[model samples]
Target chain A: MRAPDLIRFARDAAAGNPLRTVLLVLAMSIGVASVVVLTALGDGARRYVVNEFSSLGTNLVIVLPGKSQTGGFNPGNAITNTPRDLTIDDAQALLRASAVRRVAPLAVGTSEISVGGKLREVMVAGTTAQYIDVRRLPLAQGRFLAEGDWRRGASEAVIGAKIRDELFGANPALGQLVRIGDRRFRIIGIMASTGQGLGMNTDELVLVPVSLAQAMFNSNTLFRVLVEANSRESIELAKSQATAILKARHEGEEDVTVITQDAVLATFDRLLGTLTLAVAGIAAISLAVAGILVMNVMLVSVTQRTSEIGLLKALGATGGTIRTAFLTEAAMLSLAGAVLGFLLGHAGAAIIRQLYPVYPAYPPDWAAIAGLGTALVTGILFGVLPARRAARLDPVESLAKR
Target chain B: MMNEPLIALSGVERVFQLGDSEVHALHQLDLRIDSGEYVAVMGPSGSGKSTLLNLLGLLDRPNAGTYRLEGRDVTTLSPEEQARVRSERIGFVFQSFHLVPRLTAAENIALPMVLAGTAPSERRKRVDQALKDYGLTNRAGHRPNELSGGQRQRVAIARATIMQPAVILADEPTGNLDRATGEEVMRLLEELNGKGVTLIVVTHDAALGARAQRQLRMEDGELRQDSRQCAPRT
Candidate 1:
């Protein structure tokens, strides 16, 4: 039999029963939409995190004060605390390395800075002259901390736009004093907004020369080291080189760790990818149920149209033709649902972007394709039994069923 | 009968199993229908008239018999083979005038040819001829529900005979129609029989049975009467 005729019959049958068709489509659309939306969010997050990490530069390696995994590392015949040594001294020593471009020892703590009568608690970061270069922070108004300022232990501070607004009005205070806890520091320049980086709003921070932060916060511990590679091509080499140098300086105590932007992003992507698949997998159960629903509906249709099927058979319709018609009906319904789901999911993604644009930035294409493909396959796979049942029906028995 | 038997059923027995209960619908029935013959099988309800028609039409199989159509035994053909045999050699008309509600009369008429993989041009040609032959040309574009009962039955007949099947099995062809409409349908079948197409009508109405050249009366799953009619005699 001609394929078009079977398709026409399937289309007509689906159209004839609007309520059932609509229900099946609705069920399938939810599955496809869920898969697409979750996948988009996860993939976008992976992309964003990778981009943020890349902004930190290639030659950079961060040293933490803890083990990468277990009990602890002993500085001896084995590796040393070099990777885990997150300290200002290591930051200083790294600066002396020939391969390293620049190193900035970073200390962060929260403090309430009061201006006149108003007060706001903001993140206070301490670093030296190359803080801007290593952290890749651009200046908005004033100059970043200089080597001279840090060497002289000057009480100079640079603030983000949000910090400037909270601590002081729009009036320029390029040379006014601001209190860090009880100590006073002269306001220098303001940093440009970098939106949100790794969930921290960069614009909500206050920056001071590392010396002033050390005196004000009353702590000498540096949480992380910021390093910069000279060129893009030597990023990994710079990272490894820095690790070796830091390890030797720290006496082989393996406490510090180095992570490239790509490595961090890969981890983030793997985690998010798993989460997306999990959500899509959970929604797949519902999709499978919807497929079963389609199968049941087709079964009912076959029973209801017993005599009609017999009539078609008597009119010379082959069994294959009958089976193809039902299968086509199911497949078309599934594909239609997938299409509707895709449109709805895109709309959903847009809404998320409008509401939380900073979070999910990119929607991956594979999710949409996978969702549609799964729905179509599910529809046909489940529809097979009913189609075969309809096809194998005896014309005599069917017509006589009445 | 000197004429060739286009349909022959020998020692046919059809039994149905209903929840551990066995019921015989056709019992050792032997029958022969000659080419171009117009015959009506009549019986009360449960008399196996429809069962015999089903067996002869290849819509079913007999457990204890041989059914030969055009000199070929078709009792043991596969389901697909049966469908092909039914499509090419057997036509069907029902009391409900079973025209697909969604299809136009022309599409219905061309269904058999389409299923048989006929070329589009040939299918169109044959469908057009059938529409003209059944006086349904004007109703070709109408769906089953859109046409009157008489017109719908005509379309059904057109569809059934489109492939020029050797045998036409009609079960209560006009049972749902009024007297005038029923007569019109009978006349159409008679006209086709005149064109050398063997026609078999299954009905309970003795008046309708009178129109055939031969009559077979079934009772309690058995062939109770075999009579030859000279002129529309019941």
Candidate 2:
């Protein structure tokens, strides 16, 4: 038969039994939609985490104090706590690197602050004037600590937004002399209400000069060093240069671990990419199931239409033509199901985006195409047995069945 | 070519395997049918009349011997070639009026041409002429279930003859109809035979068989009688 007539004949046969057609289509569509929606969710999670990490700062290289053992059973270096301490001078020495743009030596401690007849314990972060620039922080009111000698601090402090509200309420908090850990320091600035990053809430911490913070805590060891590279391409250079400079300053001891932001981002991307593929594999199982369903329904259809088949053979339809007709019917049903499933999956992804606007839940192009291709292949593969069975039926016997 | 028969079966033997036992359906049967001749095959149940009809329609293959149609040795032809011969030279009318229930009268009549890959314009023209000739023009759009038994049989006949085959095979064509409708169907078959199409009717009804110019009676997988009259009684 001609292609158009064959298609019409197959279409008519499928339409002849509406219930079976709908069931087969529904099975296939569900399989495809699951693959699409699951992949979208898996990939969406990867994007969300990568976005949060990228928002911290660009071209950042962090220096954690201690020499991490590459491979050994040494318990002392397991937690990366080496005996040698990273001091303020070691952080200052990193400034000599050509790729380093700004360096912030950090020191952290808990202190009780009494101001406006109110006393509260606050987490204190001590750093230089360049700390704001390196961390990309914004000031809500007044100025940050002034730029001066790194060795001597001018007894100035910066209060976080939460601390300012709790201690002063409606009162002006800028320039207030707040006694923190038995030392009186003038509040130089109030920080903007930025949320959390890597577990620390910027809104609730008190910022002070690193020199005074170390003296007040009776410790000479700096907490960490945050380095900002000149550009994205300079991050690796800045990291290696800072490590080498810090090693020389630490009396030739490699005592600090330098890590770039891109390495961490790449690790997360790979982990989530694998997760998306795993879920897609799980969803593909349903397509196989749908293929089997097509096979079962088609078998039943062949048995039920024995008389019709017999009539066609009696009317001079070759077995090959009969086989082609049945296969065409199967393909038509599968194609319809696949298209419906594609639309359903997109709608499902759209609903996910609507509910969680921050998440990008679009299915990848390869995944959508793969789902459609697999559905078609599975349907046709399972259809072969039934088509052959119909072709081999004895016309004389089948005609006598009625 | 003029002396040759339209269908010739010589030393044809058909065997059926029933479990481990073998049953002979047609025992070395020999028959010849000429073009435009009306013949009736009459026999009791299991006497091989149905087997003869099936063999004649090429629906079943003989285990031994040669069968020829239109001067071609058809028994040895490939299945595809046999289908082509069946499509072009043979037509079948079943006892139960086996019209596809899903299709309209018009589509059913166009089925043979459709299977042969006839062009749409030609199929439409021929189907229209068939519908008019069968007096089913008004019922062209109706399915088999919507038509009466006589109308359904008319649709089947129209489908059978749509290809204008050289021979028409009718197997108890009037078995499912009332007496009056049966006579009407017989008259239609006779009308086609009058127009020079070879007609073969397989029936057990003596009265129906008596209307044909030639009759072959079978018993025990063998022909018991072969008789021909000068003319079929009106």
Expressed as tens digits, the lDDT of each residue in B1-234 for candidate 1 is 355478888998999998999899998888888888889999999998988887777777898988888778888787788888888888899888887777899987887887787888999888888888888888888888899998988888888888888889898999888999989999999888988889999999998898888999999899999998777422
lDDT of 2 by residue, B1-234 (tens): 999999999999999999999998899999999988999999999999999888888888999989989888898877777788888888999999998888899999998998999999999999999989989999999999999999999998999899999999999999999999999999999999999999999999999999999999999889889999888434
Model 1 residue B64 distance off true place after TM-score fit, in angstroms: 2.0
Which ranges in model 1 have alpha carbons more than 4 Å from their true place? A37-59, A64-102, A107-130, A138-157, A172-189, A208-223, A230-236, A250-268, A361-367, B1-4, B17-24, B119-122, B217-234
What does candidate 1's lDDT look like per residue over A88-179, in tens digits? 67677776766678877778888878778778888898888887877777889878776763434678888888888766777776887878
Docking class of 1: medium
Give the DockQ (2 decimals) of all models.
Answer: 0.59, 0.65
Q: After superposition, how far is residue A378 of candidate 1 from its true place, in Å?
A: 3.4
DockQ value of candidate 2: 0.65
Residue-level lDDT of model 2, residues A1-402, one tens digit each, is: 999989989999999999999999999999999999999999898888887777666788988887666544545456554457777888888888999999898899999999867999998888999898988888999999888888789989999899999999998998789999999999989999876456456788888899999999989888888889999999999999998898677665677788988999999999999999999999999999999999999999999999889888888989999999999999889889999999999999999999988788999888899989988988888998899999999989999987
